[model samples]
Target: MKEITRIIAFYETLKRKADVACALAMVVYVEGSSYRRTGARMLVSEDGFWEGGISGGCLEGDALKKARMAILKSKPELVRYDTTKGDDNQIGVGLGCNGVIDVLFIPVDFENENNPIEILKKSFENNNKPLVVITNSLKEPELLGKLFYFESKQSIDFLKNHLDVGLFSEEILALEKSKNYNIDNELRLFVEILPKPITVYLFGNQYDIYPLIELLKMLYWEVRIVSEPNKIQNRENLTIIAPSDFSENLLNKNSAALLMSHSLEIDKKNLRKLTTSTVKYIGMLGPKTRSERILNELAAEGTKIDSNKIFAPTGLDLGASTPEEIALSIVAELKAVFSGRNGGFLRERELPINERNQEIFKFN
Candidate 1:
């Protein structure tokens, strides 16, 4: 999400100038193992400026040249890089990643409303709605580089003529991540899913909350400080909401709350408000005994706290003492919880780092 945001910001600056030529390089397909999977993108400008990346530094140089060519010709081109061949001269770099990567370079047309950048901007402004982006990758010349955005079941009607709407609808309904749809080896569509960003509500106004907010912003997650508005210093992209103005309805499955006011009364008050909400995670900043006492009091008052959703003394066991270190631990735990992970060392895991299998569909 942060990469996407940076690309959009850079593109917006180019749009304002209205003279620079730029192309978007996106990894459309990946076979075997690659540093980046599908949907990874980098924006290249004619002035030799680039933002984001498509590979682990080795492929960027070659991708930059291809993107420049695409911009010069004002055409969309697909280039494949085979790294399985252990020759440094192949791409001028020893890419022993044992992977095959396919990249698509599309010149940006500022006038076209359906341009790739424009489509991405729309997806970013989708208000946390899940969006499916269909990009033509093969065979059809006219449809090549063409992009379509679908947000709901009704939007599938637009693709009925070109795709198997039944299967596509099922994929969308199931919330599948992203994959390629191959049709008789003639046409290929990269169906990419853009999910909502994780939202965090900080129920505090203390000094420690600053580091946490900064970390969350660096990850480009939506962050809101739920405290007295006057207590928070005005910062860009950080929303400050008064505690009285906070509502549980604003939270969702992708939302988390951190009670870090360091005040027993304030934490208790916030916990009570979240009891009836549908939030999946509630982190309390303090000792286990303090949080347990609050929970006990709430339970005695018939609050019915969900033990599974509460993380007393929020954060992993990182032996963190400083504010920044503690913030890092808490943010790591939040990511693990949201991803359904146990926050363990990757080296200890027997399975692959990315264990979720991507499914591909075929249609004639």
Candidate 2:
């Protein structure tokens, strides 16, 4: 997400430098498993600065080299990384993530807002709806770099300099549910749905909440601190509000919240609000006994807390004693809940780690 922002933010800078060439790299398709899913992007300027990433680390350097070539030739190219064979370069590189990733490199005209990179960033700017990028070139390559948003009624053009397009409304409408679509034998489309940034609502403005806020920021997510309005500091992408101003309407249904005042009245008040709201996750920071007491109190008040949406004795059991470690644990637990995982050790789970659905695709 930060990478997308970086690309949009640097558009003007790239545009101003007439001689400075830049290339846009996108993970058009992924087979089996990958660290970053399809639609992941990275921007490489002529100055050797890459704003995003396509692979974990194995294929970035190689992609960067290709991006430079794309800039010089003023032509787009396709790059594929298949590490499943267990002998292809990863044999010595030591980092062989078994997966097949298809990346598309396009020379970007940052000056044009209609360019694929700009179009993508603009599509996600104000809309909560998922935007899909259709391509027919990721399979064996040739005519693929075309992009279109379903709602815009745009046509799919695979062999054009710019994607100025229209597909039937019904065709675009159906893609909302499907991830991959095959238009024809030669025109296979890999649909990439754009997602809005995840918002984390941290209830309680304790000193410890600062760490969690900082960490979430690193993940490039939106953070709304529901604490004393006066404690609100000047921060970017952060909303500070007093507990009195808390409202479920202010948040989306997918938002995750953590309750950490450790005060009975405060926790109870927040819990009551959470129990009636549509927000999906509510974490209460305390011991299991403490959680039971709070649940009983709420039960007596006739607002029975839904066990499914609540996380008591909040945070994973990582022997987190320090405030920082506790903050890490709580955030880890929230990340797990957001991804619908148990938040356990990866090694204990399975061998092909990429198979885990770390990031979930939300379909409006």
Candidate 3:
């Protein structure tokens, strides 16, 4: 969600500048170690301003140059960066993690109906799910810059006249099984399937809670503020009454919730209300003692809470003291939880940070 938002924001900015053409750089394939993986995108304006990043600073300068050429030629181009040489570097990180990256830069016009970013922005803004976007970088002056988008959940009747019906059918079937991003060079397609962001329910209305709200919004996660009807401002994504208030309405089954009302009584009540819920994650803001006390009260009440899903003294041990830093820690936890990580140091992990797609293809 944040990725799509970044593209939209940069495109809007470029549209405001007079005679400022734009190009989007996206990582199509990664050979070894790269900071960002396939589907990572960066938007570069002819004026040198850019948003997002395809790689650590190592690749942006080179990408900016390619973007300028792309804008001038008004043609999409695939640029390769081979940092496998020990001497080759991009802002120091690439030297440590040498990799080969294929970046495709496509000129963009915001007003154009077929613009890829515009299409993507609409999909995200509308909260459309399972949007599969395919680009054939190898076919310049043809499908190189063009994109094929489909709502994978629906029957693709429009695909009858599609330029690559067989290709679409094969990949769509594959997608139904794995439902992940794929860089199929043999098919000449850089396929990216955008999934829905995880939903979160924040059960608080305190001033400090505002910081958390800000962070979540930046991540483009759908957050529902569950509280008293009069406690919260009528925001677009906020829910005034708690889900427990109405049995028919429940929090997203695959969601995380935070309990931080600043009042012990209210927090305890919330814990009790959500005790039996299938909502996997229940985060309580405060010291371990406070959370334990709440649990003790709930236990005495004969409520059976899923102890494994409860996160007391929520957030990583980041030594966070300020409200903003605390908010960062909390959101970090949520991200780690969503990815099934322990929120620990990345260096400790043996696997790549960007989970590699098991399905592999090589470009000839």
Highest lDDT scorer: 1
Clash totals in order: 0, 3, 1
TM-score of each: 0.91, 0.83, 0.78
Higher-TM-score candidate of 1 and 2: 1
Give the per-residue lDDT digits (tens) of candidate 2, residues 200-300: 88887677888888788888888888887766665555778777778878666668878888697888888888777777788888888888898998899
lDDT of 3 by residue, 27-134 (tens): 777777788887788888888888888977877887899999998998888777777765534433336656777788888976787686777776676654334433
Worst 10 residues of 1 by lDDT: 128-137
lDDT of 1 at 21: 90
**In model 1, which runs have C-alpha deviations exceeding 4 angstroms?**
87-89, 128-139, 152-162, 234-237, 355-359
* Candidate 3 structure, TM-score to reference: 0.78
Highest TM-score among the candidates is held by which one?
A: 1
- Scanning candidate 3 in windows of ten residues, the lowest lDDT window is 177-186
Deviation from native of the Cα of residue 315 in model 1, angstroms: 0.9
